[model samples]
Target: MLSTGGSALIAKKLGEGKEREAREDFSFLTLVSFLFGIAILLIGNIFIEPIVRALGSTDALLPYCVDYLSVSLLLAPAAMLQMMFQTFFVTAGKPLIGLMLTISGGVANMILDYLFMGPFNMGISGAALATGIGELIPAVIGLFYFLFTRHSLYLTKPVVRFQVLKESCFNGSSEMVTNLSTAVVTYLFNITMLKFLGEPGVAAITIVLYGQFLFNALYMGFSMGVAPVISYNHGSQNLPLLKRIFKICIGFISISSILITIMALVSSPVIVEIFTPIGSATYDIAKTGFFLFSINYIFAGINIYSSSMFTAFSDGKVSALISFVRTFVLIVLNILLLPYLIGVNGVWLAVPAAEFMTLFLSVYLFYKKRDVYHYL
Candidate 1:
């Protein structure tokens, strides 16, 4: 949410030829995000046990969760900084740099994960430490670049207008709702699968979700990359340019959705094999679930793009409404009722069903706002 809001505001400022103000807004938002991180850190430290218990951690898993959360929360500020810079870099017309920084962080994470967990035998503590370190590297680099370097959109002394903060929070509410809904839905998925298929069922769902995460990350990257352009055009009232950009974006997302869906279906076995041995119970369950879940990718890309498009246009209410219905209302209802009607297959179908259902709402929103945004 912070990243989306910051990118939109900065892009809009740039479009308006307010470079200095854009830099000020960027600095302000970065500070706000870091403060948010500090708040979460305190909360996590104070309520780690309660939070883990609330997450339904078993007695056997409590110690591990506590250890992981402890170290992870300590670097909460760095995590927020990394997320903000990833988007801000794009808004600053340095998307390639943003991608490189993210990749650097990911590579660091993998290398450290092996060293800490395999050789050092630090278990969950090592995992947490590695993740924190991974988060810190890009964050520190981004901070140094923005603070010390002269760039198109580098940090400056923050000029806090409470109005900017308010606008940002409101504009980013949809993304926040989407993330929170994901957490809730994931918990429900685990509970529903546990009821039907036990620990292996939950493991199967995890494996399938890992694939979903990988594909979704691509969609996320694409959306993030284009959002600044949308915001810039919209702010400048370049209707013709905005229309062209929107068309290309929708076309790209549509093609990518089909490709991702096909890949998910055809490569289900390969994906499952990466996580577990073939012919194992978990592997079989995941393989079957992957086939069913792959259908969601087709519609999910469109839904994701729709929400992001609205955010880019500063229509947060519509974006939040779309996200709330798609991620929470529709998915939760399907998860609760469908499994009862059609068994485990229904569970696998829930996300696909929800995404398909939300696509209609997305289309309506786009058409309804076409006159206002001039994008249709």
Candidate 2:
């Protein structure tokens, strides 16, 4: 949300050819992200134990949670900075560089995960530290790159613009809401599954959802990559080019949704096998749920893109409304009502139902705003 919000403004500024203002806003975002990181670090440390407990960690899990949280908090600022630069880099017309930087960070994370957890035997703390350092590398490198480079977009004199900051926050609220709703929906799914299928049920659901996460990541990356272009064109009032981009993006998402759904169905066994052995109870449950849950991808891509497109257009309220309805309202309703209606299968179908229902709203919003955005 932060990254996209900042990128929307910066991309628009670039389109307007206000290079100095763009750089200043870039600096503002970077500064804000850093301060937020520091705030998180301080608050997290101060209430670490209570926070862990509030998250429902039992006594047995408390020690491990504490260990992980303690190490992770140290890198809070870095994490924030990393997020800001990821999209800002794209706004700067260096999407490939952003991709490379992220890939490098992921590689560093994987390497450190192995070394720290295996050789050093640092346990959860090792994992936390590895992730923290991974984020830190990008944060530091991005800071240096923007600060020292002579690109179209670079960090300049920090001029805190209150109105710009407020707009960014408002524009990004939908993404934040989506994330928060995911957490809430996950909790709801767990409870629903537990009531219907017991402990093994929850485990199966988790494994299947992990597959969804992997596929959703691809959709998210594509949406984010295209967002800046959309914003830039919209800001420039290049109706013809903006319309072309919109058509291409929507077309690609539609095709990919069909392909992803088919792939998930075909690869269900393989995906399930990665987490459990064949013939195990968990394996059987997950395989079944995975197939049923795979139906969601067919509808999810368009819904995800709808919210992102609105954000790029700087229509935060409408974007947030779409996200809230899709991620929270519909999902919650389905989870609560479906299990009772169709038993165990209903639980697995909850997300698919939610996504399918939300697609109508997404399509409606897109058509309704076509005239306004001149992208019909």
Candidate 3:
């Protein structure tokens, strides 16, 4: 929450002091930032296991998690880089470049996934490599165009401002925190599920959890699109526009939640087939569990984006509190309560239960902050 919202806030700043502060010309800076994304994601891919190992919980469950996590983190740096640069471009009135960079990279990633997953015999590592290389491609292209071709909005040079870097980090820290929360929760779930459900159970949870990520990405995208609008309007003191944007964002959230739920349930067998085709019944069961897990999307969408809305306005405490409700407190309750309630199903039901509770939590938080946010 804090990282994501803060990044949006930082985007708000690009419209301020940009010309003089753009120590590097727009082209060079874009290139540098693009490089930064590739570097960061690569770091995440290479270091993820070591970071997990540093926590000192090397159960049998650890190995499997390391493989799945490595693949996703392969693209995380590029994703985060997008967050930072998107703010930069949007503020400069060149949002289209950022959007094109993201969409193109994502499409390329899918193509690479297919190529490496089979014909290249890279297996999991191949998938990771494909995603990582795919992510860097458009970043290269975007940087090339920015540096060699297009006119940047306000940037002038590629000078280092420790302050700008710090601000960018600070602004985007909420996303870091939110994702870190995910990593922690995943760790806890893996360990705990292993204790009760065993390795197969843990694997099942993983497949379902990946489905969760897809749903999360959609909602997060909505937040991403809305963040700039919120930041720009609030900065311009256009409260009415900001409020309208927020309302429309909620609509997006709702629509996504509903669509994700329907799709997951209706397509459960097909979705399951993606990871577990025929040989492994355990994998199939895991996919079934994944289908069950998608039930939480609607509530999750409401709770998460509302938290983001708070952070965009620079209310870090509120943002943190809201995140705590969904990520920490609700999860903890599920961890403690669910296993006792319904056995294996209890474990599967835990997420939806947590999301259900967080929906109310989000509304309450919104109410408490209504006065502060009423102008928007």
Per-candidate local distance difference test: 0.91, 0.89, 0.66
Q: Is candidate 1 or 2 superior in TM-score?
A: 1
Lowest-sum lDDT 10-residue window in model 1: 53-62
Better of 1 and 3 by TM-score: 1
Backbone clash tally (model 2): 0
What is the TM-score of each predicted model, taking all chains together? Answer: 0.97, 0.94, 0.80
**Which candidate number has the best TM-score?**
1
Per-residue lDDT for 31 in model 1? 97
State the lDDT of candidate 2 residue by residue for 72-184, as single tens digits. 99999999998888888888888888888888898999899999999999899999999999898888888899989997999889898988898998998889899889888
Clashing pairs for model 1 are none
Model 1 has a clash total of 0
At residue 95, candidate 3 shows an lDDT of 67
lDDT, residue 364, candidate 3: 80
Q: Per-residue lDDT for 1-376 in model 1, tens only?
A: 8789668877998999999998898889899999999999999999999998887676877899899999999999999999999998889899898899999998999999999999999998999999999889999999998989897799889999788887787788888898899889988998899899987898899898889889899888998899999999988999999999989989999999999999999999999999999989999999999999999999999899999988998888888899899999999999999999999999999999999999999998888999999997
Q: Which residue runs of candidate 2 sit more than 4 Å off their true CA positions?
A: 194-200
Report the error of model 2 at residue 107, Å: 2.1
